[model samples]
Each structure stands twice: as C-alpha cells, then as structure tokens.
Target: MVTRQRLRRRNIGILALLLAGLVCFGVVEGVALPRQDQMEAQYNAAQNSPLTHDIARTSHYATRYMGNASKVTGLFRSLPLGPIRSFALDPDVFTVQVNLDASAPMAEIDRDRAYLYSATAAFAYIDNLEAVIFNEGSVAYRVTREGLLTWYGLDGFAALTADSAVWKTEVQDKLAEQDYARRAFQELFRESKTLSV
Candidate 1:
C-alpha cells in the first residue's frame, strides 16, 4: 500500500511536467512560429515570387518555343491541332476547332508533338486531336487547350511553408485569388488532386 504523501508527490510531478509541456508548445506554436511565418510572408510579398515569375516566364518562353517549332521541324501542311477539345472554367468555357493537314508529312507531325509536349509541360495543353479523312478525301487533325494558370499556382504553393494562424489565413487568401485567375486551378485541382497533361 502506498502512503498518501507519496501519492501526492507523484501527482505533483505529473502536473508539473504537463504544465511545462503546455508552455513549450505555446511558445513554439503561438509565439515563435507566427513571427517567423509573418517575416517570410512579408519578404515574399515585397519581392516578385520566384516560383510565379519563373512559371510565367516559362509560359512565355514555352509559347515562343512552340511558335518557332514549325521552322525547325517544318510546317504542317495545314494549321496545328490543339489538344484540348473543350474546357469549362465555371462561368467561362473554351471550345477549340483544329483542322490540320495530316498528309503534310510524318516529320511535321513529330515536330508538332514536340511543341505540344513542351507547352503542355508548362500549361494545360490538351491532346484530343484525332486524325480523320474528310469526305473530300483529305486528312485533318483537331486539337484543344485548357487552363494553365492553375498548374502554375499549384507549382508555386509547393515551396511555401507556414505554422501560424495569420500565415495560414494568408495562404488561403492567395489560393482563393488564384482561383479567379484566367486558368482556374483550385477547381481543377479539386477535381484531380494530382494534375497531368
């Protein structure tokens, strides 16, 4: 049988440990983490985001790269078919029509594929194009385009970290704003956790 005095001491020791733990957790989560998250957020707000800028710049460069593809691999006998067939961006919807000459040359199709793959890497390049021989006895291709900004924003979010309520709110706001961008990413991501072209 344990004495009352020893039982009291044991309770006091456990209480003391619990109090210390609470204090340490409070300091780390409430005090230290908030300040750090705020400082980082401030720094990010002031300077251009490396991720966004890089992605934007990449989008720009990729567009240019695709534009000049025909010169390197040779022009398709006709227009290039977009990969996207249809895109529904909530209030907005984009429908594409692609009618490229398939008989132009096999090499031309290969080059176009390279352009599509590269742009798709940076943006939402669709590939629903189908090779069809029209009633006129001619071959044609169709392509489509989709939201690209969403991918850019998601790629950016991967670099940010936070542990404060304020910073967490800020992150939420930024993500919300990204939804309104030309290419709605949140919806797309919600539909597919891991996006792929």
Candidate 2:
C-alpha cells in the first residue's frame, strides 16, 4: 500500500510541472509576445509620420524665427520657461488660457506673430506634450500641417485635466475680449506665409 501511494504522488507532481509549462507558454505566445511585437510596430510607424517631421522642423523654426529685434526679445520672455512664471507650478498636463488682442496694431500684430512662434517653441520645449486654442468655441485656421494631421478631436472642458497635454492659452482670451478670431492667427500664417528659423 505504501509503494502504490508513492507512485501516485510522483505521477501527480509530474503532471503539475507539465501543466505549469503549458500555461507559461500560452501567456508568452498568446499575450506577451504579441504585445511586444505591437509596441515595436507602433514605434516604427510613429517615426515616419509627417506630423513628427513637422514638429521637428517647427522646433527649429521657432528658435530661428525672430520677427523684430524687440519682438524677439519679448517672445522669449513670455515663453513657458521664461523668467515670468514657474511652469513647474502649472499643471504638468493642463490647458492654458491665452487672451490674444485681435485688434492689435501692426506693431502688436508683429508682436503677436512672434508670440505664436514662441508658443510653438514652447510646445517644442516640452517633450511628449501638445496644445490647442479655441476662440468662442471654433478652431483656428493657422494650425500647422503637423497639427492638423495629428489632431485627434475636441476636448471637453471637464476632460482638460485628464488630457493633460498643456494648452497654450496665450491668445484665446484676448481674441474673445476683442470678439474677433479672424484677425488673431488668420493673417499670421495666411499672409506672412513664413515659417522662419
């Protein structure tokens, strides 16, 4: 009777070992392996996107494109990282409320243009970050090719924190105060047709 029980116990132990091996293999092939492959494919796909290219180029342009001497100096000042405010205090992932003066004079327009560049530069400064602006509830027309191509969708106000991509609110309030979105970024990208630097 003792010998028979030993034989039975050995057989049960071998069965347990075999079952564990099959379970591990199933997890590897059915879940882990495929997930790894998918991540690699996504990385490869993202490398060549036009928006990625634009972002890279835009970053360079922001650094190089200085409108006027004073404007250039001023733009760098308002930058998210500038001497003004500690962006670190701002939500790491949040929307900004910019109030642009739509009725700005030619000088202000010039300044505004530089501000836009600085905004792009700000976006460039932060990695894995993004921003959007809305005037009275409509999207502007000055968005870059990359921005348009990569735009996912509208973000409800309640979801702002959840989105955490950082919105540049530099010109939104200014435009709303003036009640005109047409003059804000419209003439900047449309007429200037320039992406300096």
Candidate 3:
C-alpha cells in the first residue's frame, strides 16, 4: 500500500512539472514571439526609409579618408527627387540641375527636405565642399556649409561620425518630421540667394 501511494505521488509531481513547462513554452511562443517580430518589423522599416538610407549612406562615406565630387552627384541621385540632368562642380560651389515635371511641381516642404538632406550629406562626405545649389529650372536653392552648420548649432558637422542612435535623433529622425524639417529648411536657406536659372 505504501509503495503504491509513493508512486502515485511521484507521478503527480512529474505531471505538474510537465504542465508548467508547457505553459512557459506557450507564453513564449504565443506572446513573446509576436511582440519581438513586431518590434523587428518597425526597426526594419525605419532603417530602410529613404531619409534613413540617405543619412546612413552619407555617414558611411564620411568614414572614408577622402571623398570626391562624384560622391555629391551620387548623393543627389539618391534623393527621392527626379533625376539630375547635369551638375557643374566649381572650386567651392556644386550646382545640380534636376529634371522635374513642370505639370507636377514638387511640394515646397519636399523640396526643402530634399535640398537640406542633400546638402547635409554633401557637406558631411566632401571635405572641401562649401555649398550645394539645386536648380529646378525655374528657381534655385543654395545651401552653404557655413549656413547649415550654423543652423544645426554645431561648430563642426560631426553628425556623420556620430553614433547611430545619436545621428538618428539629431538628423535622420528630425528630418523625417515635417515641422522640424521645415524649420531647419527656413533657417538654413532663408538668406540664400534664390535666383532664376
């Protein structure tokens, strides 16, 4: 009788432990796994965003010892805007003629973001770059290295070499927000000469 009682008790304890293990496995699979997947998706989307890509690309080039004017052309092409028709790189200023549809002009805010991001990337990569001008046929926006650095309130635009999280907070994420981008655009380009090309 005693032996039978002991065996029954041992079996019950083993069954309880197995049930507990199953519960833990269910929680991890049903709840934790989905949460982790959702977070991963959001991160991937942010990293793949156009703005993020531009920032990351510029950051990558900045790590190089020297950068050329071709990098600037590459930067403009990477923007969401239409293709570049032609570009003339002076000793200090780089002018880009972009092909845009007259019927469907880019939005003002979008133009600002594109120009600002491009200038930011240019100044970051090209060490001797002074200014960048984007000509949309009708008008042109000139962004100077001095003006952009001043607007960003940084003595040197070391944002390119900053840690990923810091760069995102200071540049990438801010440019993604319309209000912040507009404010930066106005601050950097307000005094710029917008001449008819």
Candidate 4:
C-alpha cells in the first residue's frame, strides 16, 4: 500500500535518529561520564586528606584537640563557605574573613548554618577556642563557646560533638533544616551589623 519512495525516506529518517542517539550516547559514555568520575575522585581525595580537609577526620575524635592556629586554619578552610580570605587568632578568639559575594552568595539562613556549623566544629576541636567570629564586610557574627554550650546544654553539647558520625547527624544534618538553623542561630550567635571604629 506504501510507495517505495515513501518507505525509503522513512527508513533513512529512522537511521538518522538512531545515528544521532548513538553519537549522544558515545559523547556521554566516553567524555562526560569520565570527566564527572575524575572530578568526584579529586573531591574524595581532597576530603580524605587530613592536611587539606580535617573537619571530618575521625582520628581527631580520639584526641579532640586542635592544638595550634595552623591546625585551626585547616579546619576552617575545610568548611563549606569556600575559602577564608583572611584569618586571625587572638588568644582564645578565632576570626575569619570570607567573601560573601563569591560563587553562591549566602542567604541569611545559609550564613546562620555556616556560622553554627563552624562554631560547633571549632569548639569541639580547638581546646583553647573561646569564641568564633565570622566577618562579612561590616557585619560580624560571633558565637562564644559558653553561649553555644548554654544553648545545647552542657551534657547535650558534649554528646552532640562526641563523635564524627554523631556530629554529622546532630549538627551537619540538622543544620540543613532552615527552621532548626534559624532557631539555633538566634540562640547561639550574636550578630553585630556595624563594625565598631
């Protein structure tokens, strides 16, 4: 019932589509997937390195002591806020300046989450750390060890940061919730909008 010419055209069109699909599959399998795998491998390597990213270092769990400023800097750098532009360690206070405008600009909730997680980690790992200050332009967020402890309760705080897995679940996972992060920030962090001259 079909003409020979019409049948030939349909077969050619089907072949063309098949060829295009094969090209796409080849590009993804040969190029895109391998690239993605390489990137993931690099990230995993970085994450596993203590010198680079030690925030998740389980070995530190047994000791629970970040003895010096250099070690503390490594911990802060490993945080999610990209990188620290500048860092200051004054006796017991740790302050860091970060570019809020870089890449993904942080919302208020995100800032709170970052501050809370950083503060909690700092207190947990740094033996001498009394407070952490995060500076973004004129605004600074300060979370004191005493304040955080009070917010979490002494026993609760100890339990929360006791282990890597527990810290991940209690602090990292819980911070993902905006409501909990909001309240936690309100209770733990003190915000100063204007830097005193």
Q: Worst ten-residue run, lDDT, model 2? A: 81-90
TM-scores of the models, in the order given: 0.26, 0.31, 0.60, 0.62
Off by over 4 Å in 2: 47-163, 167-197
lDDT of 3 at 171: 68
Best-matching candidate per TM-score: 4
Question: By summed lDDT, which 10 consecutive residues of candidate 1 come out lowest?
Answer: 128-137
Better of 1 and 4 by lDDT: 4
Sorted on TM-score, best first, the list reads 4, 3, 2, 1
Clashes of each: 6, 12, 0, 0
Off by over 4 Å in 3: 1-54, 59-67, 92-104, 190-197
lDDT of 1 by residue, 46-69 (tens): 323211211222222222222243
Select the stronger candidate by TM-score from 1 and 2: 2
RMSD of each: 18.4, 15.6, 6.9, 10.1
Write the residue-wise lDDT of candidate 2 on 95-174 in tens digits. 22233334432343433444454445444433322342312112222333244223213332222212223332322223
Candidate 1 wrongly placed segments (more than 4 Å): 49-197
Q: Candidate 4, residues 1-197: lDDT per residue as tens digits?
A: 57988999999999999999999999999999999999888876755222233355533432234446567666676665544566655552344333343444577886777778767767776655676777776567777788888766664355765666776666677765789889988877777542231
User: Which of 2 and 4 is ahead in TM-score?
Assistant: 4
